[model samples]
Each structure stands twice: as structure tokens, then as C-alpha cells.
Target chain A: MKNFHLDRRQLSVPYLIYLVLFVVMPLLVVLYYGFTDDDGNISFTNFIVFFTNSKTMGTLVYSLAIAVIVTVICLLLAYPVAYILAKGKYARKHSFLMIFVLPMWINFTLRITALKEILTMLEGNLAYHPFLNTVICMVYDFLPFMIMPLFNALTKLDSSIIEAGYDLGATFPQVLKSIILPLTVPGIISGITMVFLPAMTNYVVLDMVYNSTYIMGSLIGSYFSSYDWNNGSIISAILLMFIGFFAIFTERILNRGEKEEQRI
Target chain B: MEKTKTIIKMNNVRKSFDGKINVIENLSLDINEGEFVTLLGPSGCGKTTILRMIGGFDKPTEGEILLDGSDISMLAPNERPVNTVFQKYALFPHLNVYDNIAFGLKLKQLTKAEIDRKVSEVLELVDLEGFEKRSITTLSGGQQQRIAIARAVVNEPRVLLLDESLSALDYKMRKEMQLELKSMHKRLGITFIFVTHDQEEALTMSDKIVVLADGKVQQVGTPEEIYNEPANVFVADFIGESNIFNGVMTGKMKAAFAGTEFNCVDDYETGKKIEAVIRPEDVTVVKPGEGQLNGEVTSTDFKGTFYITFVQCGQYEMEVHCLENYRPGETVGLHVLPDNIHIIPYDTSINNFEGMIDGFVDGKGLFIVFRDFSMFVDAHRLYPDSSVSRGRLIGQDGEHIDYQGKKVMASFQPEDGDMSDDAKKGDIVGNIVSFYYIGDHYSYTIRTDNEIDYVVDDEDLWNYGDKVSVILPKKKMKYRLLEEQKQEVAD
Candidate 1:
């Protein structure tokens, strides 16, 4: 009874326990299996097999290319919608981001399947547009992720800054280049992170739409389903390492311009 | 000295938004080149709207805006040769000081070396020579304000618009910026259109000020002209501290106001109504029997260099700014020089009321009925039918005529109405619900028990919860018969 007060340290106990049970333990087990071989001997057999196999290496390169392409396309498509929705007049009457949000409320599989049916019916077959169909489904699934962050960023921007640019003799193109796009960098980075990182491994879109191409997620899935724990764990371990590096790498580049200066 | 040409002219410009009430009414103005102008008014007076129109951010709804004798109303803001320093010093948060100042210069065809030289030159002009590399967010508010100014001035536009740019700084910082901005205007020799609601700032910095109210230009003149010879009561009240009284001409170069008659310089028709404006600084304080009126000192406030002493005479409270100080309850006499008294002819904006002629009284007056009270007046004074005198409405054929329930429109100037502490002396009684002091006189709105209000201008101060009576004299009123309406609309 004397110690019944809920302090800040005590408040985080449940979160710490959840982290250990769900995140740390699974990561450790995967690492152990990924680094060791049969008979429980520690070895580099899984890494050697993964890196040496041309098919597996080729899948990684292919997945990277698809992720990059989808992210660029999604950004180019979502920016205009987000900017228009964030303006004062249009934002008051309707939250246009709900256009993306409503589709997201439906089950992901059903939405993707519906999109696949439309694309297949239009193109006559999914085989003819394996890369195109895969790219479309990936962008369709991740378009909402791109728009929400950009909208949030654009709305928080002070309209007076843009006006100041125009007042300072900047044309429309110059304002977009120097004032508007630079201000929304935080949202753009987050949108890219949310879209690109997940697009790299979303093999479900490929399997449902084309079934003719392979991505990192399907490669990991196939190896694990065949009871090949070492190879599957190695693939998962490589991906986890890649995500960890990519996040820090992106942050470093974003903050690179803000060098320390002597305060006057 | 040569007369500078007109740089900008707004011809019959009317601005409204989305079918709403107009923010700026039909306004025409001229801005001369190399002159510093200030659009001065209170909040929502369309001072900022005028600046926006000049900067090409807003377009006139019905008129042409000419820049240097050409129509530039449809040009974009970037295409116009004028720039604005927004109220909050809208500096780009991402850019450093040097880049922000050079933002405008880069839009032209200047080389990199020339842009650098011009940026440094303008930075020197704003006295922030070494702050070019500093980030905008790290600088103080006053510094950001300087950068915002530097950015616009670097472009060397024909005109510079400042939208309350110094209001964000502290009191001391704002004062310093005021002087700095004045000097900057001197060196640049450009047309500066500064917008501010602060009357003191306008008086201190502007060469000419255009006072605005109710979407209309109230007066436009140099600071001294606007202060000494205001066109109307609104200009007099808005520009400086002045005692505004509803005056009536008594004789040539003579008017009576604030319950006393005084000599003035301007001559109007005898019995012509006017507004007499006398600044507090022009009022001389003297001993009780030495001046035109005697009053008891009600209060004295010690300003830095002088004292503002308020004296309550018979009914008017006189404000005097003098070096001499007096204690409360002291008796003092206030006098104004004849030349110092500015007389402005009154406009016909008055309070109109509806009343009905009930009947006639025996040699006293005809009975008149109103919503709040009723009064008696002789019918011949208003409607001269020649036979309506002697308290009798005898027609020309010697037949007795009935004059009851006849509608008439009665109107009086707000100052013509008087108030009395005694309820029996007035035609109606009401409580003084609210009142505002228009520098010298108190404008009071009295609400009667029936929820009717009478707005009267009195010089005396009344305490809270005091019930007073309103007296509207028939001699000071004009009445018109509503014969063409065919039906009584007084009710």
C-alpha cells in the first residue's frame, strides 16, 4: 500500500515485458538458428549458401529495384493530392486523405484481389504485365502510407512563408523548389520510409497478381515452409540488418546539412 | 525642391469578398514617389486590405489600380515592383540570413558576384553586417524583422509595404525599429507604405497618413494637418487626443460647446452646427476666476514630462496637459486660444425618431406622442397651416380640425439632447447602461425600462447605477409630416 503510486518507471514495466517476449526473444532465436548448422554447431553455412546462390542473390536485386520504382511512382502520384487537400478552403469541407483511408479500411487481401481482377480484365492476362502488375499492386497497397504523412506535413506549413517567397520576387516554380518542397522534407522522408521499406519485401502482391516473379518475402517464405530453418532464418536476419541500416542511413543523410556552427 | 510625381493611384477601388460586406469601400488614393505614407486605422478598418491591394495580393472589385500611370491591378505579386514585410516577419525558417536577404536579388539577371555584393550592401543598410550566415530561427525577433526588411529593400522596388512589421517586438525593440525604419526610408528614398493601427507610430514615422474607418477613408493629410485641422470627428478622435464637442455656431468666428461659448478662427453661418476640436496640449490651466470657465480638478495623472489634469466644470470635463500639477478637489479654470480652436462643419448624420401628433393644448403646446415619452408643442412651429396657432387647429373656413394620430418624423443631433439628474424635469427617464469617453465628452447610451435606448453626448461623468432623464427640446428638432405614406407608421 505504501508503494502503490504509479511512477514513470513503473509505468514502463508492461512495455518492457512485452518487448522482451515479442521482439527480443524471437530475434535471438532467429539469430542462433541463422548462424548455426545441423547438430547445433556454429557455422557460416547459411550465409555462404545464400550469398553464393545466384538465384537468391538475384531475388534481392530484383526486390530492391521494384521497391525503388514503386516508391518513386507513389511519391510522384501522392504529392499533388496531399498538397491540394492541405489547403485551407478544401481542407475545411472534406478530409481528402479519407479517399485513401477508406480503401485501407477494407481487408488488404480483398482490396488487392479486387485491384488484381481489374488489372487482369483490362490487360487480358496478368502474365503480360508481370512487372507492371506487380508494380501497380505494390503502389496501390502503399499509396495511402505515402499520402498521410505528406498531408500532415503540408498542413503544418505556415502559408505566410509561401507568400513571403512570392513577395520576395520568387516565381511559382522557384517557390515550389525553394520554399514549399524544402519545408515538407520531414513528411516526404517519412512517406518514403513507410512506402519503400515495406515495398522491398511485400511478396504477397507478387503472388496474388502475377505469380511469375519472386521477391525477398516469398524467398524467405518458401525456405521456412520447407523446414529449412537455417536458410530461412539467415534470410530474415539479413533483412532485419538491412532495415536497421537503412533507417539510420536515411536519417544521417537528412540531417547532413545541419552542421554545428559557433553561436554568436 | 521639385515635386515628386505620383507613383501609384487607386481610382474608385472597391473590394469585397464572396458577396459579403465590403472590407474596403470605394476608395481613391494617390501615393507620390519618394514619399513615406502610412495607412493608419484601428483593427478591421481595411488598412491592411489597402496595402494588400497595393502589393497586388488583392484585386479591386470594380476599379483600376494604376502603378506608375499604368494599370497593374491584374499583375501577379512577383510581377509587381513592390514587396511587403508581413506582420510576423515571415522569414524562411530553413534559410540562413544571407540567403534570405538575397532571395529577391536572385530572381533577376544579376551574376553571382553582383548578388553577393548587393546582399552585403543591403545587409549593411539594415545594420546586420555580420549576421548573414546566422540561421533565421536562432536570431531574435528584432533581428528577423531586420532581415525581412533587408530582403525587400535589396530588390530596390519602387514601393515597400510593411504590414505592422514592428508589432511583434518588445516595447523597447519596437521603438528602436521605428527610428531605424525611418532612417532606412531616408536613405532608400523609395515610396514606403507602412500600415499600422497604432496612432503614435503613425504620427512618429509617416510623412502622410490616411486614416480609415468603416471601410471608408476618413481623412488624408500630413500628420500636422490631420492633427490640427481634422476633416471630421472621426479623424480628430483617431489621430490624437482631442476634446470633441457637438458645437453650434453662435456668431461670426464664435461657437458654443461644452456648455460654454468660445471664440474660434473659422466662421460658419450663424446657428450652423459644427464640431469644435481642441487638443489637450492647447488647453491652458489658470486660477479659478481667470479663464472662461471655472472647474474643480477631479484628477491629475503624472505623465513623464507633463501632467494630464481633468477638470470638471458645470457639465463638461475638460482635459488639460500642462507642466503645472494640481491636487484633486482643487479649483482650476481652463481656457483655449481662439486660433487653437479648429471648427469643422458638421455632416447630416443624426438620430431620427418617429412620433405622432396626439392633440392640442390650450396655449401651451400640441400634444406629441413617442415610444418612450410624450411631449407638448405648438402645431404652428412644425407644420405652419397659419390657422393652427393659439392652441387651436381652426381651418381657414373657421371649422375646428382634428390633429390627432398624425405621423411626423422628428430628428435631433445627439448633442442637442440634454440630461438631468432630476426625473421630473425630463420627458423620459432611463438608466445609463454604458458610456464611452470620446477624449473629452462622454457618449452615453441610456436604456429605459421599455428596452428603448437614447444615445446622448454629455461632458459630465455619472456614477454607476444612476438613473437619469433625457430632455429633447423641440426648438432644436426638425419634424416632417408623413402625409404621403397614407398610413401611420409611427407604431
Candidate 2:
């Protein structure tokens, strides 16, 4: 007689339940509070208050500006590093990758505290340059987030394609422009999303470096701490919507790029 | 014959990965323009290394590679007028078929119109006219292969190097691509240097075949010449199915093997040891006593085109391929015509001797005569109370004694001997005839006095034609008593 055995896929049931309870249920609770008032009455007042408050509106704009700058800076820095790590002297590349990833192993708050101390020593009274300090801190913390994806994409590239480019009379610059950069677009988009979405609302990095909480993430934290769950939930729901739109936008970019490549 | 221009010439090229071992030693070859020259060998035999050197993907450790009488050894791959279709058609996945074909041309800064025209022309040549807009991943392996060719050939390189390009395709696809590649070579009129391990691929498409083994070239000839007149035992065994035997040249154009004297076309020195190779298809079956050799059919296998019949003749098995099948255990006679017999000078790489054990002490050592030389040997484990070391017989009183003669058959592995360059301090003197670096050790064939050959596996690097002395260790040598000697001792 054949012995009964569990199908391998059935083992993932616990994980599926955990995801629904911890992830989907929390989003649903926020959505329920976002569209209701404290008296259990339907209302749009929380969203209107979030949109019209001058402090929140200015913080959102400043947060978006800083996130865009950090994402661009991280991309510009990571692309070359990832390329060198992927295609340079093969023996040294792995150790170099280890050096980049070693920082992530340390506790995140411990790293931020050390960076803040270093910045305070390098430049006296970092409070006056809060914007610059926060942007710098966010870029430093999330740089690996950018590098990890780009490095993965760059390393997985077929080396023969590069050789073929050279064989077809292409110079090094031409090969990179025409072949390497175009093929690594998915990594570029994913790296951008990982950096931009996190850097936008990560007030802990800003608060640690500048000793101030002036961003939308700080605004939402204050609301929740003061027992104004209604407004905090509204702000979080809007942020989720923005993050969802960004994900779809990047995905669309990837698909469109693929279509363009096929046209060629 | 009209003189053809030499396109590429590799002179005394040697390549080594580490400083200690050489992969290709003293290899030199020339490829004529517009000819399909194939570097054929088993894998790791440095065939791909030669192709890489020609394509400028690799540089040799020694010597020079010349193109059109100019040294191009130090030139980069792109700097040379050569292109390579890599083993698996490394097509760019990001680009379509047309863009891949036009990649090289666009770098030349050609006009867009000119690029499209060239791409379309090459696409049409490869019979992929409608595949211009198709993504590379969408095409089948064969279509991708054709696109790879079109991409390389569209550049109009002076030389094209194919590094086992058809190895990934199926059997039928490979066959189809072989003919297509041959026609492409003719139409392009460019020198093609192909590398493959398949002998049939070399025979089918190459105008000239260079057979290599262990990073050394064995022979260079046309397919017919290589098939019919193999240079050595390796080539004869590698090119086709053959029944090879140890033969002795008794007279001019006459050799004896398989208990019969056969007439051969090749003339050799009288009394010279040789090897004979006969293709399986060359043997004909006849009635008993009607042919040169009589044997019984042991087994017959139907192989679609023909039947392979295995016949056992006097302790030797010969395979015969013919249309007529015979039943198992049926008596049959086989005959090989004069032209079917091929004789090659013997090149032995192993040593075995039929000697006699002259005498042995019950608790001491033994003495044996091998090739008329009496030597003392340690007692084998089968016999107790007998011991010897370093050619000295151990006495019961712990002193050395001598045993002059014995009748025995002695054997020793070639690696168990010490070979010295100084000829004076030696047991056997010989010249190194051939040497092959078989990865771990050097296999050397040494021809001693009276045409006796001994193969030695050594770690030292010895040049060809070096005279050396070989001494076999007493502990490593093995011996057994002859039947007559045992009977005489018993009586």
C-alpha cells in the first residue's frame, strides 16, 4: 500500500493565514477608520483635515522633494558600483559586495545613531542644516536598497551579449549605452522604487540626524500618539494609495520598455 | 596545384594555465584562405584554445600568431578582422533580430538607410526575412543560430571562427545546419576555422581536419586520407570502427596476425613489430575452409542498414559488418582482401615480458630470467618466508644472499620505475619516442634495445628523443612461475 503524504504546497497554509491577519487585516482596519468618524458616523472630514492642514501639506512637499533627490543620488551612485561589482575582476568583486552588504547586518537604529554622531562631529550644530542632514542620512541608510537590485540585475546579465556587441564593431562606450544600460532597466526601476518609497516617509532617519520631526511621517506619528486615530488612518491610507500607484507606474515603465525593445 | 594564400599561421604556439603544466606544447598550423579548417579533438584537448587564439579572445604563452604574414598575437579581438559565432549563439536578449544584425554596422556610423539595407540582405541570406521584428527569446534555437551567423557574417570579416556552434542543436537540426554552414562558407569566400569534437562533423564540413589529442596534433589530412591512412593507433581507433591487432612484419608488404600471414600494400622493414587495422565492413563471410580464417558466429545484431556479426576465431574476436546475417554458433569463414589490410609501425606504450622462473628458496627470495637477464625479486605475498628488498635476497641470518637464475613471467607497471637522464646508472637504456601530458602525469613511450618498448608515467618533463635509463624497483616488480618450471620443480 502507498503511504499517505502531505503535498508540499499545503505546508504554506500557515504563512497564507499569517499574511491575511497581519497584512491584509491591518490595511482593512485603517480603511474602516479612514472613512468613519469617532461617533461611528460616515464622514470625509478626516481626509479634508489632512489635505487642508498647511503644516502637513508643506511637510509632504518637502518630504517628496527630499525623497526624489535621495533616489536620484542613490541611483547615480549605485549604477556604477553595481556594474563594477558585477563585471570587474571576478576574484575581488565578491569581497567588494561583502563590504557593501556588511553594513546592513548591524542594527538599523545603531547605524543611524552612529551616523548622527559622526555628522555632528564633522559639522557643528547640524540643526541649522536639517534638510541637508536628513537627505544625506536617508541616502546613506537606503543606498544598499538601490544597490541590491541593480547589482542582481547587472550580475545576471549574459556576458556573451557584451562580447557579441564588441564583436560587432561596437566600442566600449557604445556597448554600454546600446546594450548594457538598456537591458538593466528593470533593475533601475526596482531600485528607484525601493529607495523613493522608503525615503519619502522614513522620519526616524530624519529625526535621528536632525533631532526634529517635521515631515509627514512625523506628523502621522504625532496624531497617533495623541489618540487621533481618525486623521492618522486617513494619512496612512493616502500614503498607501500613492505607494500602490508608484508600483503600477514602475511596472508600466518596464512593460513599455520591453515593447520598445521589441520594436527595434 | 595552384598556390593558395595563407590566411592565418600559428607558429610554435604553446599555452599554459599554470606555470607547471602546458596545455598546448609546440603547436603550429596554417590555414589557407577560403578553406574550412577544423580543429578536431576530444574536449580539453586545446581545440577551443586554438580558436580563441585565432579570434584574439586569448593569447598564447609563447610564439607568434600571424595573419597575412603580420603578427596579430597582441591585437585585441575587436581590433582583428575576425568574428566568432560563440558555442551557444550568445544573442542579445534585449534586442530584436534586425537590431542584433545591425549592431556592429551601427557602430561604424553608417546611415540608417544603409544599416536597414544591410540587415535585410543578411536576414534574407539566412532565410529569416520576416524575423526582423521578432524578439530573440521568441525564436527557436535553430532560428537563433541562423541569426547569430547572420550577425557575425554581416560584418564581412576576413575570417570567421565557429566554436562548436551546432553542439546545442538536435541531431536533425545539426545535420541541416552543417550543410547550410558549408554553403555559407562557399558563398562568403572567407577563411573559416571551426572547432568541434565530433569526428563526423569534421569529416562532413571541413576541407582539412587536424586531429589533436592531449593538446598535441596527431595528424593533418583530408577526411578520406585520415579515414583510410590513419597515422597511429589512436587515429585508427578514433576515426572509425576498426579491428586492430598486434602484427609482425615478416617481409616486404607482408605481415602476420590472427594466426595467419596476410599480404598488405604498405612496405615495412623486415622483422619489425607493427600494428594492423582492418575496418569491420571490409571483412567478407564465406563457407568453412573457403576463406583465410575460420570462425563461428557468436552473435549477430541487426543495425537497420547492415548486420554486425561477431565471429570468434582462435581466441580472438573479430566484428564483421555485412548485409547477410548468420545464426549464432554457425560455422563461418572470413576473408580480408589485400587492399583491406593496413599496417602501421608498432608504437607500444606498455611493457610485458614472457620470462622464466629459474629458482626460488623456500624462505628466502627468488631469481628470474627476463629477456635473458637474471634478476633477483622479492617474494610475492602468496609465498611466505621469502623476502627481498632492493635486489638483495634476505638470508635467515639477516644477511644478503644471491640467486642467479629462475623461470618466471614478470610484469611491472610503467610508473613504478625510476627514469634517469644519465644513461650510465640504469637498468634499461632507451630513447623517448613520444610523450603526452595526460593531465596528471606524463605518458612516455620509450623504445629500448632490440625494439622493446616500455611506457613510463613520470612527473618530470623530458624532451622528445632524450636517451635515459629506467630502473624498476624490486618491490614494485611482480612475477609468477611458469607451468613447465613449476612441473619441473615438483618432479
TM-score of 1: 0.81
Candidate 1: pairs in clash: B366-B377
lDDT tens readout by residue for model 1, A34-132: 999977899998999888999999999999999999999999998988888885455252446676768889999999999988997899988887998
TM-score of chain A of each: 0.90, 0.86
* Model 2 residue B171 CA deviation in Å: 1.9
Worst 10 residues of 1 chain B by lDDT: B382-391
Taking the tens digit of each residue's C-alpha lDDT, what string does model 1 give over B77-148?
A: 899999899998878887889888888887787899999999889989988898879888788788889999
Best by TM-score: 1
* lDDT score for residue B344 of model 2: 85
**Residue A240 local lDDT, model 2:** 92
Candidate with best lDDT: 1
